[model samples]
Target: MKLNVLYFAWVRERIGVASETVETDAGSINELLDELSAREERYAIAFSDRSVLRCAIDQTLVPFETSLANATEVAFFPPMTGG
Candidate 1:
């Protein structure tokens, strides 16, 4: 499937792009991340700690295990903090 992967904040800085269209055969978010991490050192660095990251599928927050079937957009960002 084709997915639009979006990166935010430090995630974008590390990856060096705000978003990209990716072709993947991943069944879940974790699988997609693994594929990306294996692509280059930058991706590995950006996704190094899954615990500090947040994800949304087509704008709806979801767990890493969430199925990616029929999903077009996937966003990765840091957890928001209130000041």
Candidate 2:
């Protein structure tokens, strides 16, 4: 399926793009991350530490195990902080 993958803040810098359209055979967010991690060195680095990452499917925050079926967008961003 085709998915609109979005990157924010440092995630975008690490990935080298703000967003991209990708064709993936992944069933869930974690699976997609696994596949992306295998695509290249940068991708591996960006996803190297999952603890620093957060996700949203079609704009709704979700867990990594969330299903990706019928989803049109997936966003990855760093953990937020506030003072």
Best by TM-score: 1
**Candidate 1, 1-83: lDDT as tens digits:** 99999999999999999999999999999999999999999999999999999999999999999999989999999998999
Instruction: Give candidate 2 misplaced runs (Cα > 4 Å).
Output: none
Q: How far does residue 50 in candidate 2 sit from its true spot (Å)? A: 0.4
**Scored by Cα lDDT, where does model 2 land?**
0.97
List RMSD in Å for every model shown: 0.5, 0.8
- The C-alpha TM-scores of every prediction are 0.98, 0.96
lDDT of each: 0.99, 0.97
Name the weakest run of 10 consecutive residues (lDDT summed) in model 1: 61-70
Q: What is candidate 2's CA lDDT for residue 64?
A: 99
- Model 2 Cα lDDT, one tens digit per residue, 1-83: 99999999999999899999999999999999999999999999999999999999999999999999999999999988998
- Candidate 1: C-alpha lDDT: 0.99
Which one wins on lDDT? 1
